[model samples]
Target: MTDFSGAAFYGLVARLDELIATRPGGADGFSPSARVRTHQNGGYRSAFRGRGMEFDEVRAYQPGDDIRTIDWRVTARTGRTHTKLFQEERERPVLILLDARTFMRFGTRDTFKSVLAAKAAAVLTWVSMEGGDRVGGAVVMPSGIVSHRPQRSRGRILGFVKAMAEATQNGFGAPPPRLEPTLAEAIGRLRQGSRPGTLVFLVSDFHDFDAAAARELNRLSLQCQVTNVFVFDALEAATPRGGHYPVSDGEAISSLNADSAAVRAAYAQRFAARRDAVEALSRQRGMAFIPLQTGDDPAILLHPERMQRTRSGVRGAA
Candidate 1:
């Protein structure tokens, strides 16, 4: 929860525009991959089926269109012929499931993992809103206290950004000082609420939720266009020293330390293994997993190699 004041928000908004504009489409070399589903068709439904051809209009047949719909026998009238029209449905909903859990607080760079998560959510929300799509999401931390309904306006995105900013602020003070929520259950609830075909973004650290949690994500991915953003802290990748450090989640404090060189190496190995497990799950599920680090630039994460202008640079993609 970096002090996300007005300036930071505005900067993020500007960067988002640049990212969306320059991102390449379809399967290519260094394009920012937007997931494409060729085998599935999923989306929302219209409340009413309006009369007349709303999208594709058809000309009235001389004596074909089931007589009842005939233009009141236009021949009896002025001899001119026509039919009333209607429109088709084209709106889709984008649901974002952000995991603002306690583990996200770890960082050794410019900001915490939680701050990066919020920024990503803001960027996605703004992009979807600008694209004339409904945007909504849940800030699943301390257990799911904050969630916004899917909406189709810039104002709604702003409201979501504001709420996320505040939640980040509150979360920074303590992991879950009051009654907080768990990530595993929160994701399950989000899956249940989402409709089929919703472009769902499940943003989180994906830390220590167990097999049940992994299964829930697998289920959600099968039904919707699921995108997983794995938020990570530079600290989690490595420890600064070979000693211990006192860590707390606002509720209790504990020490993680290693005495001998062998023990320290073992500790580091175990830490890396856990991170690898998270990546493995994403790969197994075939979900687009984007790893976001604390020190990394958000613009780079969204646009990938747009910052690089050289042919060789693009040739060597990360």
Candidate 2:
């Protein structure tokens, strides 16, 4: 595995803010194959649910012009019949569903999964802004889920960056009085909250991703474009060099015997099983699946073409 532990492992708000200058390595327009559905005016052809609300410029009234669009004041001023022209808006709502559970805080290579998720989330948030798409996300905390509605503004995106930074650095802060929300619960919340045509990025390590989570995800896919970002560390794919290593459970520490080849093999198989299980739930090629390892440069790696070229290398490693 490629390890960059000495150089980088954790990232804070400043680090996330720095990612605003990030540029992806591909020309992967958001959901290239699917039609664009958004709120604000920008690129691609799009219309509001009921009618086109963005007004262009006024011109002389033409034949078959909508009577409601007639500009009475402009017509009276110019002593001519005039009508309003409405253009379609093109801005998609991008929602990032993040898993900030305790397990995501662990990593053995370059950075923790939580840090990686934050970095990647920052990159995506900036990219969406650049594309003129509104940005927001839902974070799965120990207490429950925190969600931000999509908005076409820089402040909203930064707020999202801030939330992720705190989540990774400070964590969800002491467990709730009741219980933490499961991945399924978080997904269910998103399913109910998200609107049609929104693009969703679900980032997680697939820990405790159960049938309930899959069902919720399937339902969510019907309305929004869902992409599964599978985050993992190098150690998860393989055991380290054979030796007696110290392990911890927060409450106590223990030593692990890694000398046995069978044990190492079993560990690798378990990782593969978990990965395959999540991949299966990703709905094949119909849904986007991104594999983000701990050592990856998320800004460049997230591009569709770059991801396509590197996918084999990522999956082939372990």
Query: Cα lDDT of all candidates, in order?
Result: 0.59, 0.70
Q: Quote the lDDT for 49 in model 2.
A: 26
- Using TM-score as the measure, which candidate wins? 2
Error of 1 at 273 (Å): 3.3
Model 2, global lDDT: 0.70
**Per-candidate TM-score against the hidden true structure:** 0.65, 0.72
Cα lDDT of model 1 by residue, 102-211, tens digit: 66765666666776777777667655654556778787765455778888766776777677656555544443655557666777777877886677787788776577
Over the stretch 1-318, how does candidate 2's per-residue lDDT look in tens digits? 222223343342224444454545442345444355323344544333223655666899889888899989999999999998775654557888877777787776566787787777777776677667777878776556788888777887788877776666443334333456788888888777788767788888878777888788888877777888889987877777789888874557887678988888887888878788777767553567778888778774445456444332137322
After superposition, which runs of candidate 2 have C-alpha atoms over 4 Å from their true positions? Answer: 1-31, 34-91, 172-178, 307-318
Instruction: Record all residue pairs in model 1 with backbone atoms less than 3 Å apart, i.e. clashing.
Output: 52-85, 52-86, 53-86, 54-86, 54-87, 55-87, 142-180, 142-181, 143-181
